[model samples]
Target: MKDRYTDFKEDPRFKIANREALIGCGVAVINFIWWFGFAYGLGSKPVDTYTYIFGLPAWFFYSCIVGTVVIIGVVILMVKKGFKDIPLNHEGGDDL
Candidate 1:
């Protein structure tokens, strides 16, 4: 039998990290908005537990959940796109 898939990119591609980072950035934005709203819209009061990164509220809780889901979804999508090792050759080895 032959392996169904191979490594994505010759070595491990940065796609996974890139996707996770992208997702984290996005989540950060959302968190910023959420905190900004709470801070400015609701009141200029900052939460005691969390501190600001650059004078902005740190929405840690929300970021964790949303970031994880977003990153996993992105990685799964890349995998579905045949991002894994290239199609195997008939000679029983993966084609470069």
Candidate 2:
């Protein structure tokens, strides 16, 4: 296979796709944390204060929900379109 950076720039969609993929990955992480916190915390809400980056308690809670949805949506978009042609790198070319 070819080196990713060498060939990725050839596609004009690469930049936009790269940005979307990064955003999508970030969303996925945040979503995973939100789910983990929700399952573990059991309805105990996130607090908003000087420690909180968003604003208020309600904002934090709603943002988590929205983040979850956006993350999943972006992931779907990435997997369905952005990565359709990328070959997977593997060891031994068979084990994976």
Candidate 3:
């Protein structure tokens, strides 16, 4: 092992951080796609031709209500299963 240094080239924490960042970006992109697809797909129709679910527009119900529930569940599941709560301390160093 190399001597004590604040910065290291092969730190495993870097990998974890990069992976989590990518996951966050991917989740954001997926959320945007879901909102856009439903909003445009259903909202594009004539107002009088639109259908209502629970007194909300089809697009609003599907994109906002259902999407929020689904996305929250997905994010919770991902954080619980895919993420690691790594300690933010250096190797052989004092706690930070």
Give the number of the best model, judged by lDDT: 3
In what order do the candidates fall by lDDT, top score first? 3, 2, 1
Q: What is the lDDT of residue 11 in candidate 3?
A: 80
Alpha-carbon lDDT of model 2: 0.58
Clashing pairs in 2: none
Clashing pairs in 3: none
Give a tens-digit lDDT track for model 1, residues 2-66.
36565333333455556656766765676566555544553444567556555554454335444
The TM-score-based order of candidates, best leading, equals 3, 2, 1
Query: Regarding TM-score, does 1 or 2 come out ahead?
Result: 2
- How accurate locally is residue 69 in candidate 3, as Cα lDDT from 0 to 100? 88
TM-score-best of 2 and 3: 3
Task: Write the residue-wise lDDT of candidate 3 on 1-96 in tens digits.
Answer: 457784557887888999988898888898898888998999899999999999999998999888898799879977998788887877746965
Highest TM-score model number: 3
Single out the weakest 10-residue window by summed lDDT for candidate 2: 47-56
Tens digits of lDDT, candidate 2, 1-96: 478568534655456667767877776687777766654454354432223335434444445665567677877876777654543344225644
The candidate with the higher lDDT, 1 or 3, is 3
